[model samples]
Target: MLHIKNITYRVAGRTLLEETSLHIPVGHKIGLIGRNGTGKSTLLKLITGEIHPEGGSIRLQNGAKLGVLPQEAPSGPESLLETVLDADIERKNLLNEAETAEDPQRIAEIYTRLADINSHTAESRAAKILTGLGFDFEAQQRPCSSYSGGWRTRVALAATLFAEPDLLLLDEPSNYLDLEATLWLENFLRNYPRTLVMVSHDRNLLNNVIETIVHLDQLKLVKYNGNYDFFEKTRAEKLALDAAMAKKQDTQRKHLQSFVDRFRAKASKARQAQSRVKMLEKMKPIASAMEEYSVNFSFPSPAPLSSPIVTMENCEVGYEATKPILKRLNLRLDMEDRIALLGPNGNGKSTFAKLLAGKLRAETGQFAKSGKLKIGFFGQHTLDDLHPEDTAYQHLVERMGNGREAVVRSKLGQFGFSKDKSDVAVKKLSGGEKARLIFCLLSIDAPHLLILDEPTNHLDVDAREALIQGLNEFEGAVILISHDPHLVALVADSLWLVSGGTVTTYDGDIDDYKKQVIDQARNGGSGNSPSAVSEEKQPNSGKARGNSKEARKARAEARALLAPKKKAVQKLEKQIQSLQQEIEKLEIKLADPTTYEKGADYQASVSTEIGRLKAEQEQTEENWLIALEELEELENS
Candidate 1:
């Protein structure tokens, strides 16, 4: 539904996109991906007309609606639900006019449009979108100013989704969400019935939610009719074939040049030498894929120590002595542990990580670690802790404790920083570059334990893969808290549950944890405790309770009883659609004067047909409503 043709955009004397063209068809869910600073977000802005491209055009289908998150977070006195509902401008305007519309014909038109759009369900739909984004019912009723900036941004996202425009644009939507909400959004996008164009770096999201991959490579746009994994495989094959062809052409050119060089001296071979020269001049070289610069995260292996380097028995940790965020944390960390903490945000996962990193003391109970233990901790706030005016070189020199300048520069270079980048101030660096600097700082000493909290928030997919490799190769105990499920699955060999003001050992893998998170979100925040995980594993639990023959028979009987009601609803819906088409055609004929010119009889017959079709339509609609109500009651029962 959207078309971009030969668009060229430049920023700050750097060309990000050069004569790139892309066409997104109706109902296609596209994922726009590229390396960091490759102008993915800039392309979205070009489509939205926020900024005009230097060359070519962008166009959308006529009358098609567009939805995008606002640049700024919503604020002021509006309630969250009201903000979301107001996104559907048509519904809001029609409903407001229905209250004061005095003309009978106008009232009928307004009500008919309302029914067609199912305006009655608007509130529930808004609430569902808000809840999927992690807003509870009470939170939905609160004023927008009551929330933090991040939460306010989520409300803007909720409003955009509730609008359900013909074409939707999302940019790194999952960055603001936790794993639980991310899963919910993934499921929601999988079922979205309209066109979508999203820019994301999360691999799992691209693989699960997108149907097409539109890659920005080599300053141009390339389209692939598959998901990210499929695109990767196809691009690899293409690159190999191109390389092979280029090599063959080079060999042929060399052979032709040798022939010309050797035969041009002889009069008899002049004709053959000229022919070879012509062939060599006509042959053109093929362009192979260029290798991209990759980031390296080679963490130093820590010195070996005995098992169980750290232990916590009935520990309680928090900022306040009286109000502990996490309590009774009976846990242990051996020298070779690779544990991933699982829970929603605001559930004390970070508190528990801080406790392990020696940043917080146990308010109660016993907590002990080896006397010689060293910890390299990376918290979410670590990036903010850097001095903006300090260069990467200065920061390293300060942290490394009077190390040699060459040694410090070499360390920075190992993490993908060049001499110029190392000299740049931290304030001017991009998010990914800042993250690389943090990794470089954290891995200098290679402590006995590593505690990383959401370390992949700014890293791209390739850099994250590098991190996954680095973490697996590191020989220190690790405690990771991250939203990226792929990294967690590949790196963590064990799972730890942090919820309900305590920490415990989870008995399932990452997949099981994902299913649990989705289930809890869909079920209105129920069954999210540690016990829920155990209950899910038990036989005859949840919806499978009472798996006896009697139970099976009763379930079958209920299904049989409700089958006709569903069929009736479906049949009437089809009939209504057919009848509406017929009515429109007949009304078009009645509007023409030619029918009256034929005779009064012909005109009367046409009018009679129109009346009969209207009667049938009204009756069928009533029947459909009844059937739908009955079906809803049966399903709820």
Candidate 2:
């Protein structure tokens, strides 16, 4: 749907894109992946015609619709719903025109075009997208101004989704998404029925969404017809091959030059040598693309000692104690706690995190932080903590405490801030630069109680993965609140579900958390009882919000009709039993010396298969119970 030819763009005397040509064919869900400051955002602008390239052309075929998930909020005091629905202004205008047609023929014509215009019906579309993107009913009603910057970005996203453009351009669509929302979005784009292009630092999201990798480097584009993993493997091989080819060319050129120099002095061999020299001079050099070594970072090693990390009892926390966001919350952290704090917006995930960090106090509760809890809290608004006036170095030194000048500089270098940027004031740094600096500052101590509110915010994919790995390896308690489903899945072994102004503990599974959170919200807000996988609901479909008392009755009826069969439930129980037995047999075999083949392979393969079976069994059992409960509730009536 979009085509670019030799597009080159530059700003502030630095080239962003040069001789970059790409053809984005119709209906391809393309994920734009790259490091921060590598012009992923700039490329999106070029495609949308918001920013023009200095050279070449970006051509979009006629009748193609373009949509972009805007990061910057356009001037507005609208509610989240208002902001999203406003994107359909053109349709609203057309709808208005149709209402007042002057003649019968005109009325018929307007009626014919009415399908294309439905701004009045935006409330339904906005709700559907917002719910899919992780907003509950309470959040949907919130004014955009009241939301934090991250939540506001979600509002902007809802607006973008509402436009229903043929070419969807998403920048960090998963930044505010919970696991449920991320999966919903994945399923949406997977069946988007149009073209997709997004810039994300998320590996799983990119792998699941995009078919090709468009590598941007030194103002040139290299298209790899592969996913992120495929691109990485291919990229290494391609570079090695290029290096060898370049070396061979250099050797040939050197040999030709030496022969020319020596033979030039001999009358008999001069012509042949001269011919070789000319041929060498005329040959185009085989230039190798620049290869940069990936940077590595290390957090300080911990001293041997403590076990239990952070403990909370009867915690009633919020900005104030009497009016708590969460009440009667109890939690304990072992030495190796990989806890993910999961919930929707305004459900007090960050508030609870801050309370744990001792940054804020619970109004009416006791928090006994175990044994000099070396706390490292990653604020959701990581960039906001950075002072505009202070240099990145100054913040690092101030928050991270004094380190050797060389050591401090080295830490900064790992995050991509070089000699000059390392010293540049945090105020002057770009949003992404500010986020990178936060990583350098926050991990300075390797505190036992590491509280990360939203570490991945504003980070491109590579930096995000680096941060996730760094967190994963730390042998301390981690309390992280993030919307990145993949990150949560990778790091969390436990979950704290904050919902309905109450907190509950659950073992962490990214998919399970989503199902429970949505189930709770659906029950409370909509009185709807739709099964999780039952034809995939779009009740938030249509073009309106919902229901009266009687409508709820219909939803309750639909819920009952789809309840699971008793025979199927019995079969699932048997499958679960068989799987458990098999897992036990594998464990016993792996433990014995003779039965195991290839220590690592046997252990890894068996463990992987066992984990998958266990997960499937658990899900089947949960779905069965929910279905049974619905049936019982229905039959009683």
lDDT of each: 0.85, 0.71
Misplaced by over 4 Å in model 1 are 253-285, 402-406, 526-532, 535-537, 540-637
Candidate 1 lDDT by residue in tens digits, 4-85:
9999999998999999899999999999988887888999999999999999999999999999999998897999999999
Candidate 1 residue 157 Cα shift, in angstroms, is 1.6
Tell me the TM-score of model 2: 0.74
**Candidate 2 lDDT by residue in tens digits, 1-637:** 9888999898898888988899988988777776667788899998888899999999997988889876586445776776787787676666688778688898777766665565446678778777766666776777777766766776777787778788998887787765556656765676677888888777777787788888876677778887888988898888788889888888988889989988888999989988997898798976565544343434444444465566678878777424777888887777656778766656778788887778788677777766666776668666776788988787777775776778778788877778788787777676667877776676677666677777776776666667776665455667878878778867776667776776676432456555654564444433122222221353432222122223434533433343334335556677778877887887787677764657787778877887887788788778778767755665455
- Can you list the residue pairs that collide in candidate 1? none
- Tell me the number of clashing residue pairs for each predicted model: 0, 9
Clashing pairs in 2: 201-461, 321-363, 376-451, 377-451, 378-451, 378-453, 388-427, 391-425, 538-541
Local error of candidate 2 at residue 618 (angstroms) = 55
User: Model 2, which residues run further than 4 Å from truth?
Assistant: 70-83, 116-123, 137-149, 243-293, 397-404, 427-430, 514-637
**Cand. 1 TM to true fold:** 0.79
